[model samples]
Target chain A: MSAKKLLVGIFDDDHTLIHAIEHIRHDGYKVGEVFTPFPVHGLEHALGLRPTKLHTAGFMFGATGTTFALSFITWVSTLSYPNNFGGKPFFSLPSWIPITFEMTVLFAAWGMTLSFYYLCKLYPGKQPKIVDPRTTDHLFSMTFDLDGKDEAYIEKLSSLLKAQGAIEVYIKEL
Target chain B: MSHFESPLREPLITGNKTWKKITDDIVVNTTGDIKPLWLIATLISAAVAAFGVFCIGWEVCYGIGTWGANKTVGWAWDITNFVWWIGIGHAGTLISAILLLFRQKWRTGVNRAAEAMTIFAVVCAGLFPVFHMGRVWDAFFIFPLPNTRGPLWQNFNSPLLWDVFAISTYFSVSLLFWYTGLVPDFGTIRDQAKPGSIRWKIYNVLSFGWVGEAKHWERWESLSLILAGLSTPLVLSVHTIVSFDFATSIVPGWHTTILPPYFVAGAIFSGFAMVLTLMLVARKVMNLEDYITIAHVESMNKILLLTGSMVGTAYLTELFVAWYSGSMYEQYAFANRALGPLAWSYWTMMFCNLIFPQFFWSKKLRRSIAFTFFTSIVVNIGMWFERFVIIVTSLYRDYLPSSWIDYRPTWVEVGIYVGTGGIFMTLFLLFSRFFPVVAIAEVKSILKISGDQARAEQWDEVKDDDVYKTLEK
Candidate 1:
C-alpha cells in the first residue's frame, strides 16, 4: 500500500509559493510540482506546463453548441408542427437564424462551463484539501508528488524548499 | 502576529449606532442631510420618469401618431431610443463579464454598480417596444399567448420575436448574474449594519443566506465562471438580434448584413463609455478612491479605446460594403448620412465614436480622470447620434421623393427620451444608496493575489518546523 514515489523539491519567494514540478527522467530524487498564489509571469514554462487547450475546448463546445442550437430551432420551426406566419414558408431557416445563433452561443457556453467544471471536479460532496486556510485570504502553496524516494530524500526536498525562499512547506497527497 | 499583519482591519464604512440607537436614529433623526444630494437627484429623476410615463401613456391612448414618427418614417424616435438604451446596457455587462473573464482585477470596484446600470438600462429599453406597438394594450400579442379571441402564438418567423427572447433572456440573466455576485457583499453589509432597521431588513433579504464558507467560495467561483461565459455571448447576441430586426428586413438602408457585428461592437464601445461616465461620478461622490483605484479607471479607458476603434472599423465597413455591393440605393443611403440636410449628426457620430477614444490611447489622457470623464460623455452622445443618423437620414431620403420629409421629434418623443433618463437615474440612485458598491469577497480574493508574495516566505519556516519536529524519523 505504501509505494515510494518521486521526491520533488519546491522553492519560492515570500508572499508567493512554487511547486517544483520539474521532471527527472532518470532521477534518484527531483523537484516535481509548484503552485503560486498569483501568477508569476514566467512560471508556466518553468513548470514545463504545455500551453492550455482551453480555447480549443471552447471552440469545440462553441461549434457543437451552435449545431445543437441551429438544428433544434430548425426542427421546431419546420418539423415540430409549424404554424405558417406572415405567409412565410414553413422551416424558414433564415428566420430561425437569430435564435439559432443565440442558442448555439448559449449551448457553447453552457457546454464549455460544464466541461470546465467536470475537468476541475468542482461540484458537490467533495471537500477540497485546504492547503492553507489563508489561501482563501492570503497564502500561496507549492506541492510536489513524491515518487519511490527514500525518507532522507524527502528531508532534502524539505531543506531545498526552505533554501529557495519558501515561507512554508508541507506534504500533500493528491 | 505583527500589528501590520492583522487581517481584522476595520471596514471602511461602519455604523456608530447600537441596536436601539440605530432604530431611534432611523425613525426620528430626520434633520441632518447626509444624503440630501442623492435625494434631490432621485426626486428629479422620478419626476422626469413620471412625465415620460405620461408621454408613453398618451402614445398608447391616441396611438404612435401621438409622437413625431409618421408612416413614411415608420421607424423613428421610438426605435432610435430603444437601441440607444439597450446599447447603454451593454457597458455594464462588458465591464463586469468580459473583463472578469480576462482576469482584469480592476473590474471588481465598478462592476457591481455597472451591472445595476445594465439592468436598469435594459428596463428602460423594453419600454419603447412595448408602447411602440401603436396598440400598447395588445403588446402581449408579441408573446406566445394562448388567446381566447384569436389567441395567437408568437411569430417565431420574426426577428423581433428573437429580439424578445434575446432581450428578456439578457435582462433576467444579467439580473441573476448581478444579484449572485452581490449576495456575499450584501451579507457583509447585513453583518456590519446596526440592528432593527430598514437597512438591515433590506440587506438581509437581498443577501439571501450567504455564509463566507469555502464550499460556498467553490460554488461561487464556478457559478460566476459559468455566468460570465453565458453573458459574454449573450452580450454579443442581444444586440446582434436587435440589429437583426433591421438587417433581416428589406428596408433600403436597414437591410445591410454588416449590422450584427457592427451593432455588437458599437454596443460594447458605448457600454464602456457609459461605465466611465458613471464610475467617474461615483468615485468622486462616494470618495471611493481606494476601492475604485485610478488604475481601474485607466483600464476602463483603455477598453473604451479598443471597442471604440472596433465601432469605427464598423462604420468604415458599412461604407465599403455599400460601395462594394454595387447597390446604388445603399450607396446613396450612405451618402445621405454624410451629405444630406442632417449631415451634422453624422459628423458628430464620427467624431464621438472614432476621434474621442483616440484621446484615450494617450497615457496621460487615459489616466487624467477629468479628460476621461468628458470623453466618456462625448462617447455616449456620439452613440446616440449614431442611432439617430441610422434611423433618420436613411428614412428621410427614402425612394419616394413625395415621402421625403424633414423629420423633427415632437415634444412627446423628446419628453419620453428625457423621461427615460429620469427612470434610469431614479433607479440608479436607489441602487447606489442601498447596495454595497463593490463585491467584498471578490475584492478579498484579489487582495490575496496581491499579498501572495509575503505568505510565500512564512511557508518555508512552517516547512522547517515540520521537517524538524514531524518529519524526523
Candidate 2:
C-alpha cells in the first residue's frame, strides 16, 4: 500500500469524539475513522456505519460442521466398516447426537474466529499501522483523509477538533 | 438510570485510579520483585510438581500396575482425578462464554484468571488419560486415523473416542478464547512498557501488533460474541462428553439419563469453587481486593450454591430413579455407594457438595472472606470426593459378588494426584507472575458503569486539578 498523508484528531473523551464525528460530518468534512480505547457507545451511529453480520457466517459454519459430523459418522458406521454394534441399528441417529452437536460448536468457534481475524486483517506477525499509541491506552482518535484537502480547510478542521475538546490534533503519513 | 446502582456493593476496581495507575498497578507486579509469598508458593508447587513428575515417570516405566487399580476396580483414582480436573475446567468457559452472552459485567474481573485455570486444569486432566493407559506411548490409538494394524479402525460409536475429540477440541478452543481475550490486555501492557527494553520487545510480540483501532474493536467485539455463543454450548458439551465416558457404559451406576446434566452442574460447581480458591489466594497475594471485590466473591458463592443444589438434586434423582425402576443392579449400585467400604467418601461428597453450600444462604457468610475461602476449599475437596465416590465405589463391586474387592490408591497414585496439584499451582503461579491476571481492556470498558462512582464523583468534584479528569472532560 502507498503511504499517504492523513489528518488525525485525538479526542480525550468518547463523548467529545462522538460529537466531533457528528459536527465534522455536518460541516461537510468526511470523517474517515474514529478509534478509541474501548467501543464507544453509539459511535457507529455517529459515523454512519453498518452493523456487522459476522453472526451469519458463524451460523453457516455451524451448519457445515453439523452436516459433516453426521455424514462422516453415518459413513463410518454403515459403509466403511459396518458391524452390528450391540445389535443396534447401523445408522444410529440417536447415538450420533453428541458428536454432531460438539462438531457444530467446534467448527463454528474456530471458523468464526479465523474469519474475524481475516476481516480485521490481524494475524500473528503482520505489523499494523497505528495512528497513535494512546488510542489503545485512553485516547479517542479520528482520522480524515488529506488526499486533496487544502491547507486552510485542514486548519479549520484542526480548530474544530480543539473546540470539541480534542487532546491533540496532528497529521501522520501511513 | 442511577449513576450508582448499589452504593453498598463494592465497586469491582477500588480507588480513583487512572489508566496509567491501573497499568502500573497490574503490570508492575510482573516487572517488580517477586513477593516472598509468591516465591514460597511457586517453590512449593514446583517442587511438588517435580515429585509428581517423578511418580509419573516411575509409573510410566513400571506400567499402570504400579497403582491400586485391579480387575474389579479397574478404573479408580486416575479416572476420578481425570473427571475431577475436567470438571474443574468447566467454570472458565462458563464465565468467559456464557456470562458474556448474558452480559454479566462482573465476569470481566474474574474471567481472565478463570480462563487461565481452565487451560491449566485441562493440561493436568490430559495427563491422567494418557498415563492411565498401560502403554502411554500408544495413546495415539485413541485417534481415528488410517492405520495398518490388520486394517484396524477406531470405534466411532464409542464414547471414549468422542472424549478424545471433545477434550482436545475443548483445550484448543479454550486456548484460543483465552488468548484472544489476552491480546488487548497484552497490548495495553506492551504500550506501558519502556521503549526498546526487553519487556517492550516481549510484550510487543505477544500483543500481536494490536493498535486498538475501532475496526479492530468491531471485529473483536463480533469475534467475542460469536465465540461466546459457540463456547456456551461447548462448556455444556465438554462435560456431557466426559459424563458419557461413564453414562454410555452398561454399568448400572454409570448408565443413566441424568448423568449428563448432573455432571455438568457438578463440573460448574467444582470449577467455580476452584476459581474462588485460587482467586482468593491471588486477590490476597496480589493485593487486587478492589478489582476482585467482595461482591465478586459473593456472586461466585451464589453460583456455587445454585450448582451445588443442582448436583444434590441430581444425586437424589439418581437415587429415586434407581429405586423406582425396580432394577436390582441399579438398586445394588446405589446401596453399595452409601453403605459399602467407601461410605466415608460418599458421605464426604454428600456433605461437601450438598450440605456445605447451604451456608451461603446467609448473606453474612457469603460476603465474609474467611467463610467464602473456607467453603471454596471444602467444595473443591468435596467435588474430588464426589468423583471418587462415583468412579471407585461403582467399580469396586461388579455384578459378580465373588469379584467384589475394595480398592485403595497406592502411594504412587496419591503422589501423581498430588503432583497434578503441584503442576496446576506451578503453572498458575508462573502465569500470575508474568502475565496480566485481569483483563485490563475489559475492566476499562466498564469503568463508567462498574467502577467506584463514589471515588469518581469525589475525584470529579475537583476535576480542575486532576489531569486525568481534564482529558475525560
Candidate 3:
C-alpha cells in the first residue's frame, strides 16, 4: 500500500534474507516488507516488528466464552425453566464444568482464528498482491518503496542488495 | 540464525530436501495427474459409501427397529461405533496439539493427515448418535434451544447433554485448527499454479490470499501456539465427556471413576493406531517416504505402546476395583464381561488392545512398517470390541433375570458401520488427492532445523560457543 513503484529483491534462502534485512536497516535504508514462503524463525526480530498480541486476544475470547457459558447455564438451571433432577440443586456448578470448558475452547479457537484472518486481511476470495510468486515457494523477497526516490538512490539500494546476496533484483509497479 | 540440533537425533525429514523439492514432492500429489491406484481406491470407497447411504436412508424411512436394539440390549453397535470413531479421532488432535505443545518436531510429517482423519472420524462418529435417535428428524431435541412448549430446556446435569456440546465443539475447533494450518500450504500450491488457471483460482481462494508477510506469519505462529494450548485440554475433555456418557450412569460396568482416564488412554491408543494405518498406506501410495519416514512410524509406534499399556493397566484396575469393592453387582458385571456369553468380544479386546500392542516393545517390530500397520489395525479392532464389550455386556443382562437377552446387529446396523468406514475412506482419499496431505509450509519451516541434509550442515557449523552466543543473542 505504500507505493506502486517498488525495488524488489529476491533471495533464495531465509538466512540470507534475514541478514540482508539487518544490513539494509543498519545502513539506514528502511525495508518496506519481507515476504516468505514459510515462517522463518527470527525474521520478525530482524525486521524490527513488534511481537504479536494474538494470544492476548485469544485469552479475551476464552474469557468471553467462559462468562457466556456459566451465565447461560446458571440462568437456565435457576431462573428459567428450573427443574429438580434427582433432587439435585437447581444451579449445579460441577455438572456445568464440561460444557463451560468446551465453550471456552470453541469460542477461543474460532474467535482467535477469525480475528487473525481479519487482522491479516485473509478471506476466501482475496486476491493477494504478491511481490514475487516464488516468495510462497522457495524464495524470500524484500521490497523497498521507490516512489519518492531518484534513480541514483534506486541504483545504490539495488547494488547494496546484490552485494548482500540478492539472487534477483528488479523494479516493479505493484 | 543457525539452528542447533543434536547430531545424534534422527532427522525428521530424510533425503536431501530443499524447499523447492519439498514443495514439488507434496504439491505434485495435488496438482499432477491422479494415480490409477488412488482412483481405484476412491471408486471402491465411494461405492461402499453409496451402499451405506442407501442403508441409512432405508433405516430413516422405516424406523429404528431396522437395527438390533431390543429392550435389554438397547445400545449395541451404535454407541460402540460412536465411541470407537470418536476415540480414533483423538490421535489427530493429540498429534497436532499435544505434540506441538511439547515441541515434538516429528509431528509435522503426519499432523496434516492426522488432523484430516480427526475431522472425518468425527463426522462418522456424529452419524451414529444422530441416527440412533431413531426419529432422526427430532435430533434437534438434543440441543438446548429455547422452545415454545413450556420452554423446556435440556437437563443441565445430563452427561448426554454435555456430550452434545463437547462433540460439536470438538468438531468445530478441530476444523478451525486444521483449516488454519492449511492456509499457508494452500498459498504454496497457489503460488506454483499457472496464473489465471483453474487450479490457481481454486487454490488462491482456498489460501485466503495468504501473502506470507512477516507480520502475518508472526500472527500465524502465535495463533497456532494458542490454539494448540486450547485444543490440548479440549481434546482430552472431549473423550472425558464422552466417557461421562457412560460413567455418569448408574449401571455396574459403566459407573466407575477410572472410566475417564481409561477411555482417554484407549482413545489415544486407537487413534494412533488409526493414524499409523492411514499414514503407512499414504506414505507408500504418495511416495512420501522421505517425509513420513520410518522414524515417524517408530515414534508413533512408541505412543501406541505407551497408551496401550495404560489401557491394559486400566483393564486390570477395573477388574481389581470390581473385586475389591465387595459389591456383588459390580463383581458380576466384570465377571459377566469375561465369562459370560459375550466373553468372546471381551477377550478379543484384551488380546488386540492389551496383548498385541505389547509386541511394539520390541524395537525391531516397532520400526517395521509392515508389523506396525498390522498392529494398528489390530488395536483399532480391539478398541471397537472394548467399546462393544462395555456397552452390550453391561446392558444385556440387567438387574432383572427376565431382561437378560443376547443382542445381534441387523444387516442395516452392519451396513451403516461399514458405510461409515466407506465414508471415512472416501473423504480421506479425496483429501489426499486434492490437499497437501503433508503440511508443506511447516515442513519447510523445519527443513533448516530437522531436515537430514540441513542438520548435517548445521552439525559442522554449530559449536558450543556459537550455541551459547546465539542463546545470549
Among these predicted structures, which one has the highest DockQ?
3
Q: For this target, which candidate reaches the highest lDDT against the unseen true structure?
A: 3
- Candidate 3 Cα outliers beyond 4 Å, as residue runs: A1-3, B458-473
> Candidate 1 on B1-473: residue-level lDDT in tens?
21122222212212322222222222222223558787888899999999999988877777777777875777788889899999989988887888889977667767888999999999999998888887777777776555675533555777888998788778877887887777656655554555446765565566554334323444456567667877888898899889988888776778988899889888888888888888788877765655666677887888888889988998988888888989989998988888888889999999999987988878998889889889989999999999998888878866888878888888889888999999998998877776656555565444433333323433444545645455434
Compose the digit string of candidate 1's lDDT tens values, residues A125-165: 33333333333223334555666556886787677666556
- The model with the greater DockQ, 1 or 3, is 3
DockQ of candidate 2 (2 decimals)? 0.55
Name the runs in model 1 displaced over 4 angstroms: A1-89, A100-174, B1-34, B149-151, B195-198, B451-473
Chain A: TM-score in each model: 0.70, 0.94, 0.97
Each prediction's whole-model lDDT (CA): 0.69, 0.86, 0.92
**lDDT string, candidate 3, B15-113, tens digits:** 898899999999989976778888899999999999999999999999989999999788989999999999999999999999999999999999999
TM-score of 2: 0.93
What TM-score would chain B receive for each of the candidates shown?
Answer: 0.87, 0.94, 0.97
- Estimate candidate 2's alpha-carbon lDDT, on a 0 to 1 scale: 0.86
Candidate 2 local lDDT, residue B217: 80
